[model samples]
Target: MLRVRQWLFAASFFVCGASLASTACPNFFVNGSNPSIDASLTTRTTEVCHTEYVLLASGVTKGPLYSAQHITAAQVAGADSISRTGSFHQETAIPAADRSQTSDYTNSGFDRGHMTPAGDESTIDSEKESFSMANIVPQDHKLNTGEWAKIEAKVRDLATNLGEVYVVTGPAFDPDNTPTIGKDQVAVPQYTWKAVYEPGKGAAAYLCQNDDSITCDVVSLNDIKTLSGVDPFPALSSSDHANPISLPLP
Candidate 1:
């Protein structure tokens, strides 16, 4: 059936080493556009064997970047157990006063949403490391668990189907109208965007409103830059790609 075919694709991809050439990890910022609102923020980059992540440090919060892994059926089957091993924690690599904490999300009405979902990680250690504060943002509870979550799942599906995929996802803020939560005043993003890319398939970009109501669009990379004010995956921008079709939330 379909499951067998998927497993066969996964096995063949790993066996022939075909995935390695096309799925190289990407850099933190696409074309030198930092995600910080203030000048004082620091940036941190991390490598976890099969994954690469970057933390663009802001005063109270940081933005994280991760490329989705070319996962196998075995990894997918064991993901749940690995994910349960650790909880979110502050990243010690940054100064204590600068990093976000679990306390910052306490009663903040928003969730400590992960830019890189645990599902995309190939190992337990990588999944645990994903809990670092630098990889989180103040996300609306509804959207965090809703359409955004759906998109994360879709990325995983793409990883399985395309053999390899890289995704750039993070928060987008309107500086003039920024919102804050908790005592540390972590900024809540007004919008969030994700761009999914495969070697031969070009790329698809998504934008979500980050609110209770589910409003999102799949748009061109050009549109994504205009809406989010950041250019993601600049190298792939000129690839032959189709425009995004709208998705209506049920």
Candidate 2:
């Protein structure tokens, strides 16, 4: 029954390129429009573009508000041919005061989670760039290695099967009592989310709490906007924002 509804939505929906202004790395986004963060979330931000992805790094959070990527089946195949470097470093492109240091996550009891997974990068340069701290957040070790890992793999599989997909990933902090870590005071998000747009098909997001409990859900894009204060896909039609296509979960 759910599959029927999803197929119907896919059959009827058509996504057109948005005419919004382009970012420094416009190709990474669905319609060249970078994800916009609400002023209340954080006022200071820098746009950092990498070889394979682009992100909005927040000075207040000392991490990425969101990272965007355009993935293709051929890219996934190439990424699979490479080896994991596990090389993590601070992004020199971001202002020193606003960026997180490797030391900030050291002994802080959190993993430096990548908004765009290393496995998604096809070249050695891109894989290394994936390690930049600007694309990272202080995430729970258990959640990062467990369910979140599964989610990343699932998206990669989707790219392999769907030919192409646009992805935006980021964190959501609690307004009143956000936690901080290390000397830089890097903010720890309460929840992390990954939104996927299968062009001409449908869109949906996987949202999970950054905790040992590993709670997660498949939600509408509007739900993500309401919770995170960022509309990841501003170009998608209102109906697409309101409706969530079913996604296979691990």
Candidate 3:
């Protein structure tokens, strides 16, 4: 997640708090500006922002990543998918090709995936916006559209059930050559599945799918792996777990 205050938001900060806050959330982010908070989890370099559902890929430091749309330094056509606050970012090589130049997309056979996926966003606009060069990772198309997408959907439901969710996601590698995006048409994640949570009732949850292709058991497991916490201030060291976030007043 990210945080920022544009000229349009200049007066809102003082009316409320010093700065907006957000954390590594459970859902995919699009047109991502800046959440009020930052995240605590850390991976290597660039891939940091490519974390599961959050972006902390600051080249200079290791901390919660503001939306590339929020920071001025992070701007490029399709580099970031959104321009709302301007913090959207992606790491696209100008050539958009691998050394082979055949099509890094198919040559490797690993799908160019989004750490913070697009379909995982609430609106198509947001999804389209987050579809940037920075958020892509080499993933198995099956995993992305299959379980990975389910996991992301679960993250979104978590935000809905718990008011706001701070999510962080990325490849599960201990370390490896951060995957590159070859000159292949960017793949959009398929929303074949979904997850729902009713925290107001308790810690109950459920997962559903649009297609009869994936399994329910595995989807829940992956969702748990990526998002298993109740942190109100996820931006503060990722250790600040509060009561499950509360949903917006109904």
Candidate 4:
């Protein structure tokens, strides 16, 4: 069923109301509000910004807790003309001890999955930035190339159809027993999620396990918060968080 265990926790870490506009990289978020992570779940995090996306890179996980992007019809059209150059590399801005190196995934079984996909970038520089290890996670090869790819494509299609959309993609780790890869011990997440919000419309999320089973679900924004300990859409109304719109699955 591809289910994620629900964790009951306080919403103390959430940043909302008037303070949203002051969040770092506010432009990439919905209503100018950045996603908030539960304090208990965060550790040694750094905010890394790029031309097309922004992310909260976690030292503990050696990867992004979430990568956020603002997509528009114009950007999507522009991206169509750009060629993907898979130049994955470490994020130099992040402290060396906290950032992931390309060598970590060199012989690892998992793929260097991108949170903000290169296909979403409109310019060559943006596409290159999308390959930063800070915006990556250890993902199952099959899941990354198959279902996850379709999900990314669907989000791009939605942006084209809806004119614009806000997206936040991230990984969810089991706090008690997160697996690791390479000398850096990059945490391998148990699940990966993507939340999408259309201005003046509503929001929804897609949740999938990081396994070869290929199962995934369309869940509410609130469901994502409970599973990930991060509210991807802090500016959305309670009603919007509670109700999830249908999204096509792979």
Clashes of each: 0, 0, 40, 0
lDDT of 4 by residue, 1-250 (tens): 4245333232223322322224567899887889877765566878888988999888889999899999999999999998988698889988999988888998899999999999999999889999999999999999999999999999999999999999999987766678999999999998899999988878999988899988778888887787777889998899999999877776
Which runs in model 1 stand beyond 4 Å of their true positions? 1-52, 60-83, 237-250
Kindly report which residue stretches of model 4 are placed more than 4 angstroms away from their true locations once superposed: 5-22
CA RMSD of all predictions: 11.7, 6.8, 14.6, 3.3
Instruction: Score every model by TM-score.
Output: 0.72, 0.90, 0.39, 0.92
Worst 10 residues of 1 by lDDT: 14-23
**Once all C-alphas are superposed, what RMSD does model 3 give against the true structure?**
14.6
TM-score of 1: 0.72
lDDT of 4 at 157: 95
> Per-residue error at 121 for model 3, in Å?
2.7
Runs off by more than 4 Å, candidate 3: 1-103, 176-250
Per-residue accuracy of model 1 over 54-76 as CA lDDT, tens digit each: 44445533444332333444445
**lDDT, candidate 2, at 106:** 86
Global lDDT of model 2: 0.84
Model-by-model lDDT, in order? 0.58, 0.84, 0.34, 0.85
Rank ordering of all candidates by TM-score, starting from the highest = 4, 2, 1, 3
Q: Say which prediction, candidate 1 or candidate 4, comes out ahead on lDDT.
A: 4
Model 3 C-alpha lDDT per residue in residues 115-174, reported as the tens digit of each score: 555644433455554555445545565666766565765555455444543333332211
Q: Candidate 4: what lDDT?
A: 0.85
